[model samples]
Target: MLLQTAPAPGAWERLLAVLKEWDFAVFLKINTVWTGAFGDFLMPILRDQRTWYPLYAFLFIYVIYKFRWKALPFIIIAGLTVVLTDQVSSTFFKNYFGRVRPCNEEALRGMARLLLDRCPSSGSFTSSHAVNHFGLATFIYITLKPYFGKWGLLFFFWAAFICYAQVYVGVHYPGDVSCGAVLGVLLGGFTAWIFKKYFNFGNRKRGDLTTASPTV
Candidate 1:
């Protein structure tokens, strides 16, 4: 009888190793520095709940009103999917993996980096910011695809920017953000598909009729 084995790390680790090599280190450092400069300006905007919360709230409400009751289920499901992805990536996967944040690692100890202060002993295998932002953006994109036509590409760029910002801030490794992004895309799309199938928001069946016509 053959024994079962866990799957290999796949392309992500291979890519990370390439990035970590001495030859690539200089390139990574330069890119990181440039990204960090931009991140210094963008992180505050991305990280601020005050800014995003109102924006998301307004968008959600507007979507529901614009699309009518049919949009409510999608909005609610997308919101829940975003929260769930964030919690799972941050609380479960991070704690279970217990990976060290890139900012706190020995390699970065003496380097001057731009970012908010490092998190206090938090696990860092997968970035919550990357996961949540990508997940929510992806879900919204999927839900609104029919409405947006070819413009759905814009949402994809939005998700990618947020994922890149995570690494730029020095809080997450590129590998971490990459994994989070992949997972976020899968989960977001899957959740939208499931909601569309089961929610029955637009379909009204004959069985839904409450009363029959009089026989007079």
Candidate 2:
């Protein structure tokens, strides 16, 4: 006969208590109150990666033209950062945690302001959008900060805006994006550090690694 083991006392209750206190209030406000033409126009665009291809193409061209061959390692770092964030957020966090998305929550069915035409059929504990955007932003900024100064940091705000749109569009909760942000920042820093120290990516001086020449 197998030995009987007792369940941990208040485990479920403790988890519920944390979730209850984590400000689902702000989530409801952002999802419901932020609706309008700007959201109508921007949220769907934010949700679709294809919509940003032109921007992506331009960014790569600018980086390559500005930094030449030396920028290749940094580009690889950014690509890996995004891929890692996307995979970790979806496969590990979303699948393992299996939290219900706001649009799919039974309690929020009528109330959650879903802007997208169709809701995703996946869990939303940690948003892949937030992870990928923030991760890419952080790693790229880290690599390019010396080269572009404060201007390089703008990518972070862009990532933040993208994450905000997720909450407004009702695809994710604030807590989910928050977790994703933390994860992204960590992973981004980690990747940047690896590239710098182990991969012979060179020193903090932009001139030492990549050219400071202005593009035409």
Query: What RMSD value applies to candidate 2?
Result: 4.9
Regions of model 1 farther than 4 Å from truth: 1-32, 35-39, 47-50, 112-114, 200-216
Going through the candidates in order, what is the number of backbone clashes in each? 0, 0
lDDT of each: 0.67, 0.79
lDDT of 1: 0.67
TM-score of each: 0.74, 0.83
Candidate 1, residue 44: lDDT: 52
- Model 2's TM-score against the true structure: 0.83
Looking at model 1, residue 161 earns an lDDT score of 69
Expressed as tens digits, the lDDT of each residue in 1-216 for candidate 2 is 998998775988889768855647778888887678888788878767787678678778877787677667767877898899999999999999998888888878788887888889998979998888888777877766666678878878877888888888888999889889889998888897777665433334534545454322
> What is the per-residue lDDT of model 1 for residues 104-199, given as tens digits with 9 covering 90 to 100?
776666662536654447887787776777777777777665555468667667666666665666666667777788888887877877776776
Judging by lDDT against the true structure, name the best candidate.
Answer: 2
Which stretches of candidate 2 lie above 4 Å from their native place?
A: 1-18, 199-216
Model 1, 8: alpha-carbon shift in Å? 18
